[model samples]
Target: MASYECNRDFPVEIIPSSCARHSIKCRKIIVEKIRRDRISNSIEELRTLLQTNQTNQCPEQPSARLEKADILEMAVQFLREQASSKSNESYQSGFSHCLQETLRHLSLHAPLQPAEREQIKRFYVHQRTSMHTRLSTEPRAQFCMPSKRHSTLRVRKSLWRPW
Candidate 1:
């Protein structure tokens, strides 16, 4: 039987080629087991996350057993919902800032009666409320900017007075 021995070892045991091949196979199996363990641990962690972050649990079976595929699908859906909510919040914040600036400009520069100013304020408030409601109700709500003709600040010549 052909044997291999390490020169570095003080007490070298003759290792047959068959034994060497078997050792290599054992190492491969150990490595594969470690890889599988890591994957299993990761999936377990994901399962815990899905359980904790479940806001709208199913009414039928809230504590039902979830398959790996179900957990993954729910995680994807949760992440997408989170992303959409964040984007909508950002959009609403920007819209609010613009509305405030517009209102401030009108109050400072535009010559209008108290009733007219109140009317304009109410109109904008209504629009903002409607937008918020729509965004909350619709999963895929799209915001379209007003046309250029409608969006531009057109101060009537009569309303503008240089004091």
Candidate 2:
């Protein structure tokens, strides 16, 4: 029986009697090399190429067609909570800005149907009244008082007198 060594590039020193073992090693090496080359290519470049192709594939904005009354109501509730807490001013400003942007987008792209708009208005009114009641009843609720400058503009004299 003539023992055959694997093809010239692989220094596979052991000469196997079966052809199956030799082919498996050769195929594995080829697959591994292809995988390594693929990994070496820049992923960012591939992403950019894909994005470029997709740039012209713009779909209509969801706000253009979908009724977003529920979404708007949720945003209003979130804003009210933030306002009541009186947390970081910058964060509150950013949140409000984003909410406004979303509303603007919805108005431009997906205007709500007349019925949906009415529902949204009703929901907002109900939410406001509920929040007011909760704030008044909750003992731990800390009401955010306006700054002294703002307060002074509304009143002629301090309500509390010095003892």
Candidate 3:
């Protein structure tokens, strides 16, 4: 390909010879090597991560040499476990929050007696426990959020009170 070069004072035009094809091929090889190096380095990093996780989980067990496929499999398993635990934690937290809100609102506005409220609280606890046990036995659906995007919004509360 013909190309041009620009200096501070003037523009210079240049043309390529037949060796351009060889040069282009060499560049492609170099680029491919670099890409392969990146992939290998990332795999090594994952291997180390998996080793550390395994060691942490079982200190006395010796770590064996891992193949690339094994490393990838273990990494996938680890990620799934992490995601599942996070999801379960969020679900439990949300349920607890709902229970608290329900109790608070009932205390303020509901005409039910204290004994009835206590009975409802016991029912909530029972449901929470049963759901937790059920979830522990079954694989819950996973919903993944994009790690890169998050909101940090601040809202201004109105001064007017409904109460």
lDDT of 1: 0.62
Q: What is the clash count for each candidate, in the order shown? A: 0, 3, 0
lDDT digits (tens) for residues 1-163 of candidate 3: 4433333343222224334555677789899999999999999999998788667655666777879887887677667757867877797799789888988897789677979987998888887887677555432221111121211110122111337
Q: Please provide, for model 1 over 40-147, each residue's C-alpha lDDT reduced to its tens digit, 9 standing for 90 to 100.
A: 888788888766554234223355567887776666756665786797789778878897888788778977788988898898788688767765544321111112
Q: List the lowest-lDDT window of 10 residues for candidate 1.
A: 139-148
Residue pairs in candidate 3 whose N, alpha carbon or C atoms collide under 3 angstroms: none
Question: What is the C-alpha local distance difference test score of each model?
Answer: 0.62, 0.48, 0.64
**Against the true structure, what is each candidate's TM-score?**
0.59, 0.26, 0.56
Candidate 3: stretches off by over 4 Å: 1-17, 60-62, 105-163
- Estimate the TM-score for candidate 3: 0.56
Q: In lDDT terms, how accurate is model 2? A: 0.48
Order the candidates by TM-score, highest first. 1, 3, 2
Question: Which pairs clash inside model 2?
Answer: 63-110, 64-109, 64-110
Compared with the true structure, model 2 gives a TM-score of: 0.26
